[model samples]
Target: MGPSRHDQLTIGELSARSGLATSALRYYEELGLIHSERTAGGQRRFARQALRRVAFVRAAQRVGLSLEEAGAALAGLPVDRSPTATEWSRVARTWQSRIDEQIADLERLRDHLTGCIGCGCLSLGTCALYNPHDIQGTDGPGARKLLPRHSRTA
Candidate 1:
């Protein structure tokens, strides 16, 4: 055997090596985040490179990136081959702005909470902090009324 032919791994082996559950691997495949081939018995077989890809996806999630964003970031990788350091760096750079924005939002929320804890505004229903209309549209996801996730129906 030439070089022991380590090109592919069964789904179970991939799961063990990547430290991910087989269901999560399947979910990732379903979400277009990973790829696999089927054997004659219809079992999934993944490329060995998928180990690194799975690790990257988990790391991205740990950093609070949604699966959609992670998928987009990972899409830049070439499926035909494993990613190089340069490729990984390029993908990581794409997240810089998102990370910065999250940090800024967290800081703003922290300051708001700290500033409001001792303020008399908490006693007044008309205060921005206590009024839904006043505070709801002032920050990130809810900056605009009727955000997609917050849509109201008649």
Candidate 2:
């Protein structure tokens, strides 16, 4: 049988099982995203439940959340008890809007990519973006105005 809640894992064990480096795990604790019990020798001991916390942190990161944002989500869970499925569901749902917005942004970028953004033309050389000496090109290379309308600036 696997280790029970009574059998806490050392930092290294938690790192190995969670696929996070030992330093990352320590940083998580420092950020208050995860917590560990202290041994008499001042070493860290993580409850088995910590694995689930690490998973949540990683998943949050995959969804583009900052460490602080992940910590806020994890904070909703009770520190004294393990997170339940229902609790996880509720917390994860909060990310849906953020994910959808990101998807929409990606779609817009993909659809407009490789097309003349500023000038209406069928060729690249005539486009200011393609001509380095053009006024718009003075800003520098890259999709400068390709950002969202509100986000774009001269």
Candidate 3:
């Protein structure tokens, strides 16, 4: 007989429902982003709440959060049940600054794309004009001007 709605899901079942590969699910489990129990035969079994957790992780990724960050957010949620609306809202509020930083970074990229690639590669003559003898390189590695303002070194 098929498992009931309240039954735990096998890895394949979770993968199919979540639209993630089993390998990815394994990775998430390894990272503590989601969790599963072991069957007597050592197969993984995930609570149905794992679906909501997986969705939460995907939503976090859509906002440009790293897996570590998503895991941290998930840590705020209840492990035994789906989060209440208030609980979800509280967790989501913590992401605002990160999302704002991403928005600002994208805006900076969009504003600069026409002028400088900002990799400090100095390949373009225009880079010479903006970067001036690769001065941005001293500001620390990576596309300095493309980085969010607070992330840039003085």
Q: In TM-score terms, which candidate is top?
A: 3
Query: What's model 1's lDDT at 75?
Result: 83
Question: Which digits, one per residue and each the tens of the lDDT, describe model 3 over residues 23-93?
Answer: 99999999998888887899999988899899999999988899998998999889988789999889888
Kindly list the per-residue Cα lDDT of model 1 for residues 1-154, writing each as its tens digit: 6223378888889888888899999999999888988878898888777887888799888778988878887888876677789997887776777788889877866766666676644422333433334553344333343233533342
Which residue pairs collide in model 3, if any?
none
TM-score against native, each model = 0.70, 0.68, 0.74
The number of clashing residue pairs in each candidate reads 0, 0, 0
What is the lDDT of every predicted structure here?
0.73, 0.74, 0.78
Q: Candidate 2's residue-wise lDDT over 21-67, tens digit each?
A: 99999999998887887878999998877898898889998898999
Give the number of colliding residue pairs in candidate 3.
0
Mark the regions of model 2 whose C-alpha exceeds 4 Å error after superposition: 1-6, 116-154
Q: In model 1, which runs have C-alpha deviations exceeding 4 angstroms?
A: 1-6, 119-154
lDDT of 2: 0.74
Task: Report residue 76 deviation for candidate 3 (angstroms).
Answer: 0.8
